[model samples]
Target chain A: MATVSVPRAHWSGRRSTLASIRLAVLTFLADPQWLIPSMIAPIVFGFVSFELFLGTPDLVVYVILGAGMMSMWGQTLYGSGWATGQDRNIGTLEPTLSAPTPYVFVVLGRILWNVVSGLIGIVLVFVVVVVATGTVPSIDNPVAFVVLFVFTMLTLAAVGTVFAAAYVYTRYAGFVQNVGEFAFYIGTGCMFPIVILPFWTNPIALLFPPSWALDALRYASIPGYVGFSWGLGWDIVGGVATTAIYLLIAGIVFKRVERHVLEVGNLQEY
Target chain B: MSSVPAIEARGITRVFQSRKGFFYQDVTRTEALRGVDLTIETGEIFGLLGPNGAGKTTLTKILTTLLLPTSGTARVLGLDVTKDTERLRARIGLVLGGERGLYNRISARENLRYFADLYGVPLAEREKRVNEVLEWVGLTWAADRRTEEYSRGMKQKLHIARGILHRPEVLFLDEPTIGLDPKSARETRKLIRSLLGEGVTIFLTTHYMFEAEELCHRIGVLSRGRLAAVDTVAGLRDLVGGDRTIEAEDYGFEDSELAAVRHLPGVSKVVSEEYGPVTRLTIRVRTGDLTIDTVRQNLIGHGGLQVRERRTSLEDVYLDLVEEEAR
Candidate 1:
């Protein structure tokens, strides 16, 4: 495609989509029934971590923070992308496409809410875990943890984009949600740590960017935990590097599949 | 020249490949468009007339940048479809068949406003444009009702509003009035004519021959993926030598006499099909001027021949094209 100047009138498309995404996230959070349960999973796990590492005041905080961030990654995948898949299935795909807005912005707008929703889920879990358990981990490497989480989230977004595009072929976004949930369970260690998995399963989990991220978070924030063997912060460095690579790969693959499916006139056919 | 054709196609072609379902083995490739070349100058209503599977929808998709052509090129308002797709899409309006375009869950007003925003209409200008288009399509009264609750005609009217939300320079409407009642169809037709008056270039496709004849400045008859004919209504009618078909009750001409009548200097085709006790031969006049006298004199020479009916219209032109392709 030839490069052309963006139309002046549509310069705000990115902002519009982002705003819509935030609104969708806030709206979902506004409902206490959903908010309470989704947040509880991480805090309950944090309490267990606090009990296991007695006298380590920060263990509870680290586990809760890691779990909360990890849950957000899951929300970005299933929350935003799943909603887009529903629109595609219910025959709103063409109307959305007919608009003059760039396809990228449209897709982004559809799930912008998920990013907000994911953040809300994370915050709620953090507060509950801290207040209820009285656990506060010292901030040893807050910047590093933030960097790792952001990269991990981007990797999940790439996966979500591919899964949503694939929905065009599969005709079911629910399947993407199911796949994303399964991925979250194994890759993000929602139930347990990467070390607990079998040696072979570790490599499989490592394929996803989140595997190293969770390890890096636990290693950086928790006291006396062996995070990476290859020297100072190697796990954090390696995890970031691995996630960047996964994101690049996933982005390229998703775009290719989307183009192929759309060109074949099957984009909206389903 | 205006530097903008409302619509233009240069050697455009689209091919569709069919895949067999699981457990089946037959896969086929169907060519939906075969090198169709066409242009509709700014401010004219051009009708693409064809039967089902005639590639009209494929062409519409290419023009709207929804489907890329297999080969060749198309442009809407000087923007190449493949290259400046985003900009091109912003300027063009398209309405596909039936009530598929409108969102059933939202009220008609919301649907129009949603599209208005998507097209990048400024927040302030959006309301004005939305209201103008809604009133133009006469959907203001039902703007608040969910589209699903609206009748088919009302939904179609809303679809038209959604297409023109941004005042697109060129519009493509495919079979806009296919299933509407006569009153609704007439109202929509009148609305279209008014739009044409305002200099909106329209590329329309319809199965209704009369609608094309009544609305189109020029019509292209597509058949089996090729341009069967492209001309003004009168020009197309003249293609079959301006023939006037005669249908009658036992205007008894014997078989030998019918065969003799087929040999006339100006008569092009002599189709003998069963019609009650008599047979019907849809004769085509090969010459320019076809009067009742010319047809009468030609058939009078045959002793038992009699003329029962005569009507000259675009249907004869369409049938002629279809019959010529069949042969």
Candidate 2:
């Protein structure tokens, strides 16, 4: 009997992540209706935040940073997790889960797409606020402010990466995320400073990486800021620490959640 | 090749638990596989035949590493399915050809390319391999069309293309031709046959008895989570009673008349079913000594009677094995 040649299977983290990113781009291009809700909420919140922060001393900066963070939060916090929900809805979860690649990188690729989209959302919020208020806020350090802004989004990705596992853990992840949406806004101080919300809630808000990052963004961009009083260096340290912790938790959760789904055999269900 | 079976399953079982409504608060556990043990040699097509809800898909899913079993062990190509899922998945392929498993918005070529990358096809060979599989499944013509626009048959072909894209050593196909047109289904079968040359072991689950008879080196009949029988088509035919079957249709037949036919030499088993206004008697005979003439003469006085004789089919063998297990 003649033995036939069989190609040995190769495992590449880079290849899987790139393929997942390509899939995300292709899906968004084909049917972009999903981006509607993401866009609509941000535009509404941007206008509302501009009006509500009318007469504060650093009003433009507050409105711009607050509304931008709000809009970007929708994508970076929920969009990445929702993409995992989409995978479950379309029945791609089983095939992707069964593939040789670890599912975490697949979700990582998707979160990266949402991270880019979130940054774009911030720009849209910037334009919307600029057109509404005819005044541009001055950044004390432009490069630091921009770098911190991008870093803020990365902090959200860390949180989103951990949250994306909820979709794999249960089909009701969408419902849970929806219920948590406004709470996310409150806890992360998207529209207002967390210090204004109450002393007891501050500890809870600090648990989220974005809250720390958002505080650091305020210190860098807003002049005479008095929100945390911890200064820029401490806020950055806090952001880095919280984001690293969240990512570590994400890596551990994804493995357990994938194993749990395989054990339960509900990867077929949405 | 290495003397190890391509697939070796030992007492595999899966149980599903479903919880009822809020007021009821009851949990129901249904055992999908009781204890299934099977083995298939490398480069052979092994078909599993069963009625609906007969654990066929459960067993296939367990072996493919998509679902964990409640008990027992399964090894594919010398890799344990549970412990070595990642390593085993690259060496094996699963084709669940249907609308649900595919990315409908993308072209078939894109779907295969993504999967090829996931399977670790070298970047240089990915495009060529994708194109090669598209040609194999006869989807080269519509390779660029969004799969949402393709017919179910076309999607099925694309699925087969993806399954073989990385040249997996073993492929598990769950009802590969379930909803395809005859020509497309035949093409699918032909493509499956061609894979034998590459020494790909195939595990097929299908309700089409003739397909099992035509393609499988051996067939297993699963009944309500248990294996009723496993053998070559001829061996199963002999196990059921014979190579020939005789059918007699009438309004009805008295028990004594049926008993007389049963008492005839070489008659092995007798079964009767109602068809609207009339009843049909299916007689399984072990020898050529029993003929349609003999069956007709046995029911001499029956009116509006029609008699026919032909070789027993796999359907009959399958039905016999399943029904016997039910009893």
Candidate 3:
């Protein structure tokens, strides 16, 4: 046999990351099932809150933010976490995981796309709330609101990555995802203030990254909302600190889980 | 440099655990590969031939770094598969036979572009490389068609295209021509030949005896999770020790007639199976000692029977090795 040497260029992790993100986006666009539910959940919640609040501006703002964030939670759990199971089902997981690119980056890219897709639902819900109540919630700190929103999305993406890794070992990933979607909604106060719940649950809720992010978003978006009265400075500190902590934990857990999966030869298992 | 083997396995083994029953407390372990060692020098097309469940695919997975060995080591391009998985993956490619791996909703071009990106091909060359591969696989005309719309043969071609898209130094192909039509299988073989000409070391696993005999410079036969034999096609045929095969068809044979044929000199084995009205008798005998004429005369002495001497093929060698291992 003849010998031919093909020139190999250095591999760029950033380029592979972008490609994974693009593939995730294209896959989501082609499959409307995930998008339909993400949009409908917020719209339905917005309509219900519109009637219950009787168009009161303060309560309407609460409902809009709650429903919008709830949609994000759903998208993260199903679109990002449960998507690992979908990849296994479609037989693409092994190939994607075995590629030269880091599997963690591929997963991060996927969660990033889910965050982007979830934004569509957030915007649609905001539109529905404004059109129904004829009131746009006044923002006390637009800059803080944007920063907290980004923080919340990233925190959720990290959480989704952790779940994606955990789901690799279980055959009941879909069931787990369904349970997690509702668990985060209730645990993080996406539908209502955690203060209304039992006092003992407050500390647990505060430990979750999304809860702090929600609190920050609520404080920045709704004037006089009952959270972090100290000001936007504390909100930023709390949101960023908690998000960083959650991301740190998620990164460690995901790395270990990914190694276990590859070592055990379970990449093909659903 | 040519002395270094492109692929090498040292006592590689893999075991899978399965849960049994509803409570799931019970665990059953199955050994897929049992200390199997293999080596393929650079630019050689090495074929791994085996029956289903013979650990061929498991070994391929280990060599490709898709599965870790249970208690052994494998290397590609001189890099340990376990220790240098990421770097090893970049230098080698794998094409597992099936239509399931590719993204079904995306066009072939899109799929190839995505994999090119995953392989970290430079942005400037991604499009050119994808197009070149598509053209090589003869799928440039259907490059934009969704893979779900492709035929099985077309999908197999696309699979090959993806495998070679990265221009890896080694490529592992598991049953590349499986389930393909005769013409498509032929085309795939031709593509494999062309790839070999380019100096890509191919580790191929297939059930097709003729394909392995023709394409592989050397072939390895695996049976029951172990390497039964590894040699050139002709060398393997020599394992039967110059045994000649005689196939005869007759309208049902009496037990006494079979016993008479079995007791003949130089006869090693006689296997008879009923195929509708006629019973086919396959007889193996020492070469140069038994001729079709003598065998036909002996059978005809009892009753008129049709007999033909058959050429020894790779299939016969494979069966012989497998049967020897079974004993």
Q: TM-scores of all models?
A: 0.80, 0.96, 0.93
- If you assessed candidate 2 against the hidden native complex, which CAPRI class would it receive? medium
- The residue-by-residue lDDT of candidate 2 on A61-179, one tens digit each, is 88778877887888776888888887889888877777899998888888888777766667777777778778776887789898998889889889999889999888989998999
Relative to the true structure, candidate 1 reaches a TM of 0.80
Which of the two, 1 or 3, has more TM-score? 3
What lDDT tens digits, residue by residue, belong to model 1 across residues B92-196?
Answer: 788874756555666778767666667777777778888898889888888887787989888778878887777777788989999999999988888788777
Candidate DockQ scores, in order: 0.22, 0.70, 0.65
Model no. 2, DockQ = 0.70
Clashes by residue pair, model 3: none
Query: Which candidate tops TM-score?
Result: 2
Candidate maximizing DockQ = 2
Candidate 3 wrong stretches, greater than 4 Å: A51-57, A228-238, B249-281, B285-289, B297-300
TM-score of chain B of 1: 0.90
TM-score of chain A of 3: 0.90
**Candidate 3: CAPRI quality band:** medium
lDDT of 1 by residue, A130-228 (tens): 787675547567887677667556656655665555564456557656765756665556444667666677777766666666677666655666543
lDDT of each: 0.69, 0.86, 0.82
Interface RMSD of each: 7.3, 1.5, 1.6
